[model samples]
Target: MEIMLTPAAKAGLDEWESNGNKKVIQRIHDLVESVQRTPFKGIGKPEPLK
Candidate 1:
């Protein structure tokens, strides 16, 4: 599967990497891949706001 990020998100990720926090970037990528593999199927629709 191909993962494409928005321009803004790409910038944010680039900034994050530049900050010397590759772990967070790696975590984000890992989570994205995991979700793509097994996405969350909600039980039902959201309730109406009060």
Candidate 2:
């Protein structure tokens, strides 16, 4: 699912990026990564290209 970052979320992300807050950025990255890894939204096992 495509995530639409809200204005506040965008600001937070931008701030973290600009501030070089690796911890906060890592948390955000982890959240997104976990979401993408889920089998939700009809996602199944990854398939190799034929």
Give the range where candidate 2 is weakest over 10 consecutive residues by summed lDDT: 39-48
- Mind sharing the TM-score for model 1? 0.60
- 1-50 in candidate 2: lDDT tens per residue? 56678999899889989999899798878777766666353233444558
Query: lDDT of each model, Cα atoms only?
Result: 0.71, 0.73
**Per-prediction backbone clash count:** 0, 0
Q: Judge candidate 1 at residue 22 and give its lDDT.
A: 75
Candidate 1: tens digits of C-alpha lDDT, residues 1-50:
56789999899888988898878888877777775765553222324458
Clashes of 1: 0
